[model samples]
Each structure stands twice: as structure tokens, then as C-alpha cells.
Target: MSDNDSQKRAQFLAAYDEQLRTDAETPSAIKVIVQGPLRLVTFLNGRGFITYKNLGGADQAAIQRLVPEAMAYYQADAEIIRVEWKTRGHDHAPGMHEALIDNGFIRDEQESIMIGEASALAVDVPLPEGVTLRQVTEETDVRAMSAMQDEVFGDPVSDDMAEALLRRLAIDPGMELWVAEVEGRMVTAGRLELVPGTKFAGIWGGATREEWRGRGIYRALTAARARSALNHGKLLIHSDSTEFSRPILERSGLLKVSTTTPYYWKR
Candidate 1:
């Protein structure tokens, strides 16, 4: 890899770590916005969710303290269930994965941190002759997008996920949904979140109709989203890709720097 490539990757990782610290998790289980010299993100998701930019600057005692406080915050509510601590291998986080394991939090499968220059992904791609693309932000359109995405991803249809996404869109948080249609039927769709307070935007739920693969529709939609991200001043684009989407993203110049996986803990 070239020096420029190395620098870009480092910058992308640094920004990612910092964004995790500052992003407002959600309305779920009151939020505790912790102030940290490095980067820290704590969320109340039943148990507790803690992830920091890196552990290079923190001692073991500091991390241990953080865990108890985080647990207490989540435990305050009887409804809270379980907590997870997300870790990144490329981060300056020393002994973090070890610490979580020591504390009874298990590690999950590593997911690739795919990042690339926005410009490289801004090329124009034409959809198949019969298909076209449209943006979905309205409630009905959002539901359709969600349903199609669920089918493409092999997840059970979830009205709750649709409701949550609609709620988020209602706030006009700059989240966008795009769809590919053939003869007036929705075939594939995805969501792009223009995360506020960060120089990066994320593409999620990029699903293609199994029969519609390799028709260039999904790529065109992704390009359209990339152009939008660039207009929003986001130079870096990121996604947690699977086998299907990873190759397509790699073809667009995004590198898989690391992996992330969520391990479930049930009450």
C-alpha cells in the first residue's frame, strides 16, 4: 500500500472512533454522554453498551470503573436487559478485547471496516433497461423499503424495525432510503444515514433482489448515495459489509480494514 493509502485509512479509522464517542445513541434507556479525552460511547440498551475510540490512553482501572458505572446506568431501569462492549482490532485500544472477556462479555465475529474515498464511488451507473431508482422518505414508501430490505437480507419481516426507522425519518435527521423498481414494483432498497457531527456517512441495508443481481441497479443507487454523501461534505464512506456487498464495495475501491460482529446476550 502507498503512504497516501495508509494515511487515508488512518484518518478514516480515527474519525470512526471519534464519531462513536459523540453520536447520540438513541432514545432507548436514557443516554449517558460521557466526556472523555480519548473517545467514549455509552448507551443504555437493556444491559449497557460501551465502546470507545481506543484504549491506548486509558489504564485498566479506568476501564474497570467505566464498566460498573455503565452497568449501573443501565441497571437503574428494570426493563434493561443486557449490555455489549464493541471493540475494534485496528484501534489503539490495548487489552480492551481482553478486558471485556475478563469481565464476562464475549467477543463477536470480526466485521470488516470498509472505507473509501467518496469520489471513487461517485461514478454514474445505469440500471437495467426496465428498472429505475427512486428515493423513499414518506411513511408508506419507507415501509415498502423496509419490507424489501428485510426480504433481501433474509431477516423476518419486522414491523418494529420499520416503525423505528419511520420515527427516525420523522425527525428529519437526514436519513435517506433509495429503491430500485421494475415496472412499478419495488425490487431492492437501502438506507443511507448522514450521521450528524461527523465527516462520514454510513450505507446500511443495501439489499438487491436475488433475481436482480448484476443488473447495475444497486451500483447506480449506491453511486447516487455517494454523490449525496459528498455533497454533504462527507469525504469518507463506511459500511459493515457481508459476502455479497463486500465484493461490490471492494470493486468500488473500498478496503476491508477490519471486521465487527454483535454477540447477543439474552436476559
Candidate 2:
């Protein structure tokens, strides 16, 4: 990376760490419970999320106290069976990783935080013959798409994911569920979350069938979503991308700002 590109990435990381992550999270949660410096978010279907800005500059002793306390907050609720503590690479909280591990949180693989101008990704991408893309809203289509995504990711079909998507659709119309289908069968799917009151829209869960990989369908789907985000007045697109999707986003002009690792604790 050039010096200017590195500086730009640093700036984006700082803005994202301080502002976008927390501000965007609050509006999406069904309930946000604050514990000291942490925001304990309760999502639909018994999922819990723990995050905070800079851990409020906590020292080692403070981090040790806060880590378990946050986990305890989730454990207190019978509905919350799983909790993920979202960590950023740039966070300065001492012994945070150790604290989470000691408290029974299992670490998940890290992902790159990709950000870029929405307009940069709004270019046209040719789709394969007989493949069609469109936004989906109905529960039947939503469930089908979710199941397809689960199968693509090597996880069993999750009713919870389908239910959560339906619930979110009822409350938040800003969310767009897009799918690419061949002859009416789902082949690719993803979600675009337009953060209300922010310049960012997040593209998540981009999954394509193994047989359909390398056909430019995923890229076309991303472009379609980016066009929609731009139409809705968003200037930037962000995603916590896996190895598979990272190169696709980079091809669309997004820069890797930082890394995020989610440490999960199951009760």
C-alpha cells in the first residue's frame, strides 16, 4: 500500500472505531442494555452482543473486572444463550483477549473490515445467462434464501436466522435482502443494512453456491446492492468480510481498514 493509502485506511479505521460501529449497532438491536462502558445488545432469537468504544480506556484491572461482568450480564438472562464480544485490532484494552478466554469465550476467526465509496461499487456487472437478481421481502423467499446461505456456509439450516430476518423486516424497512436465482432456484444471497442517520450501508452474508463460484454472479449481486445503497443516499459501504468475499470487495474499490474478531461465550 502506498503511504497515502495507508493514511486513508488509518483515518477510516479511527472513524469506524469511534463512531460508526457503536452508532450503527444501537439502532439495529431490539434492546441495548448498558453496563458501565459496555453496550449489551439483545438481538432477536436469543442472541446477545457485547461491545463498547475503546473499552472506555480501561486498565488491566478494569478490563479484568469488565469482561466477566459483561458475560454475567448475558448469563443472567435465560433467553441469552450465546454472547459475542466484538473486538477490534486497534483497541488498547490490556489483556482483553486473555480475559475473554479465561471467562469461557471461544475465539472465532478474524475478518477484515472493508470500507469504500458506494459509488465506486455501483458499476454494472454482467450476470450469467438465465440468472436473475432482485430484492426479496416475503417470508417464504426470505426463509429459502437464509437456508441457501446456511448450506453454502456449511451450517445446518437455522430457523432462528429466518425468524430474525422476518422480525427485522417488520421493524426496519431499510434492510434489503437480495438474491440471485437461476430459473427460480436460489443460487446466491446477501443482506444490505442501511444504517439510519449515517453515511454507511453494510453488505453482509454474501454467500454463493459452490457450483456457482467464479461466474461473476456475486460481484453482480454486490453491484446491485451498492446501487440500491447509493439510491438511498448512502455514500459508503462497509462489511466484515471473510477470505472469500474480501477480494471481491477489494476489486470493487474498498480498502481494508482493520480486523475484527468475535469471541463467543455460550451459556
Candidate 2 lDDT by residue in tens digits, 202-240: 899999999999999999999999999999999888999
Q: List the residue pairs that clash in candidate 1.
A: 46-81, 47-82, 48-83, 55-93, 110-259, 110-260, 111-259, 111-260, 112-258, 112-259
Task: Report the lDDT tens digits of candidate 1 across residue range 127-211.
Answer: 7788888888778888888888888877899886788777777765568888889987898788777877777778888898899
10 residues in a row with least lDDT, candidate 1? 37-46
| Overall lDDT per candidate, in order of appearance | 0.71, 0.90
Q: Model 1 TM-score?
A: 0.81
> Which is the leading candidate under TM-score?
2
Residue 198 of model 1, lDDT score: 72
C-alpha-based local distance difference test score of model 2 = 0.90
Q: Which candidate is the best by lDDT?
A: 2
